[model samples]
Target: MHEQDFEVDYLIMGAGACGMAFADSLVTNSKSTLAIVDRQHRPGGHWNSAYPFVRLHQPSAFYGVNSRALGSTLATRQG
Candidate 1:
């Protein structure tokens, strides 16, 4: 296998919710470069591995990146 080097101000260990949120905050507040590493093929961490019947312990609005809303505003307004 080939090895490579990377230059970044922040090296995030996972691509999970927290990691993604932190990355988003850094990107919005600074000009620092970042690298996110994850063992899984996708983001969302445990959320990806959870059973389909499983649900979030908290409201969906309480989750997700701070810069963006988790659900549609129109849907909330309608309901």
Candidate 2:
């Protein structure tokens, strides 16, 4: 494997739901170099494979990283 220079404050290997979640939170909280990589061509991980209108079993608020809030609008609307 090619060893790429990864001298960032944060380097996320997967741009999946968890990867993006952490990166987003890190960017929002502090000034850090963030990199996200995924074998897939998009974010949201496997959810993208699922049908539309199919929501996560767990609330988005609980899924994403702590610093940033995902689906805040959805949560507010649901409440």
Candidate 2: the clashing residue pairs are none
Q: Residue 62 of model 1: what lDDT?
A: 75
Q: Determine which window of 10 residues in candidate 2 has minimal summed lDDT.
A: 70-79
lDDT tens readout by residue for model 2, 4-77: 77577776888776788678778888889877878878777778777446656776767646664567674433
Please list the C-alpha lDDT of all candidates, in the order they appear.
0.79, 0.72
- Please estimate how well model 1 matches the true structure, expressed as its whole-model Cα lDDT: 0.79
TM-score, structure 1 vs. true: 0.71
Q: Which stretches in model 1 have alpha-carbon errors above 4 Å?
A: 52-58, 71-79
lDDT of 1 by residue, 8-66 (tens): 99999999889999999999889999999999997777787885455566776777565
Q: Top model by lDDT, which number?
A: 1
